[model samples]
Target: MTDLMETLIENREMVQPNHANMLESAHGGNVMKWMDEVGAMSAMRFSGETCVTARVNQMNFERPISVGDTAYITAYVYDAGESSVRVRLVTEREDLRTREREKTTESYFVYVAIDENNDPTSVPELTVSTDEGDRLRKKALDGERD
Candidate 1:
């Protein structure tokens, strides 16, 4: 079993010129790529095997991260199946100077664990051992209900 909290991952990236669009905000593609990478990491942590993204559910970019701001991305395994894990991913825009942060994106990513032969493999059951883990799982479920 894998504790849901143990699989939680957080990453931060500075929005630079190369990562921004013409409007000087972080590009949607760049954000998605980062989310995918972090989501995969969370899934792998939960599954204890290599994982590949199978689906991305309802990615919403609520706001843009302007250049010079920090993109804080968080991912956690909220659910699991025989071979698949569901990860909740969220991104926030943080101002380095003011330390203000605002939610900028949210999404759910599904990943399937794979063995050395690249075949789908079973994953350990997800366990929620902490209040924070329960809260995260509930939030992910609530978002799915919406």
Candidate 2:
């Protein structure tokens, strides 16, 4: 069994003009690329194998991340199956001056562990052992309900 906390991944990207659109906000595709990268890292951490994105479900962009802001992406494995890992990915926009943060994008991603031969591989069971792990799991579940 693998603890959920062990698969947690937090990453950050500085949104520059290159990542922004005409509106001076980060492009959705760039945000999704960052999310997918972080989510795959979490799945690989849990499975001990290279993971491939199988699906991205119900991506919600609550707000825009403006250029010069920090994009904070967090991902954790809250659930898993024989070969699939279910990860929750969230992106927050942070103001460098005020140090304030607000959620900008949220999504659930499914990844499949793969063998060297590119075949689906089994993964260890997922468990939420720590209080923080439980809290993250609960947050993912609750977010799904909304």
Candidate 3:
């Protein structure tokens, strides 16, 4: 089994003009792309194989992330099935100068591990070993109710 916290990963992207929408905020697609990328990374870390996106839960854009702000994406593997990994993704808008941050988006993604021939492969179970891992797992479980 793999420690759930060990699968955690974080990424940051600067919201440039090219990534912005007509409203001058980061585009929804761009944010989701980032989340998917990070979520795949976490899934791979847990599965130790090539992982492909299988499903994405409903995504909510809580707030707009303006251009020039930093987009912070955090992902972690919270559960695993025979060939699938469940990831929780959280996105926050960070003010570069002030260092302030606010939740901008959140979603859950499922990835299926694939073998060399591109067929589904089994993945180890995920384990929560520490207090932080327990808390994160609980939070992810609770977030689903919202």
Candidate 4:
């Protein structure tokens, strides 16, 4: 079984000019890429297999991160299927000057682990402990739609 909290993963990106749009804020695609990468890592950690993105759902951009700031992306294994894992992703923007942080985007991503032959592979069961883990798992399940 997978320990959901211990299996959670995170990655950070420093917004650069290349990642920004004409408005000087990070491009949506760049942010999505970061989210996808971290979510994939979480899926890989849980399944112990290479994971590929199957779907990205309802990514809402609530704010923006400008160049020179840091964008923190977090992913956690909140739910699972026989072969697929659902990750809840959150992107936060950190201001370098005042050290403030705010949520910038959120989405749920689904990934399927594959064996060496690139076929779908089985994954371990997930276990949620603590209130935060349970709360997050419940929220992800509630927000998921097929």
Give the top-scoring candidate (lDDT). Answer: 1
Off by over 4 Å in 1: none
Error of 2 at 124 (Å): 0.3
Worst 10 residues of 4 by lDDT: 137-146
TM-score of every prediction relative to native: 0.98, 0.96, 0.98, 0.93
Superposed model 2: Cα runs more than 4 Å off: none
* Candidate 4 lDDT by residue in tens digits, 73-94: 8889998899999999999998
Better of 2 and 3 by TM-score: 3
Off by over 4 Å in 3: none
Clash list (residue pairs), candidate 2: none
- lDDT scores for all predictions? 0.96, 0.95, 0.94, 0.90
Best by TM-score: 1
Count of backbone collisions within predicted model 3: 0
lDDT of 2 at 55: 96
What ranges in model 4 sit over 4 Å off?
A: none
lDDT of 1 by residue, 1-146 (tens): 99999999999999999999999999999999999999999999899999999999888999999999999999999999999999999999999899999999999999999999999999999999999899999999999767
Write model 3 residue lDDT over 21-137, tens digit each, in one string.
999999999999999999999999999999999999779999999999999999999888899998999999999899999999999899999999999999998999999999999
Residue pairs in collision within model 4: none
Candidate 1 structure lDDT = 0.96
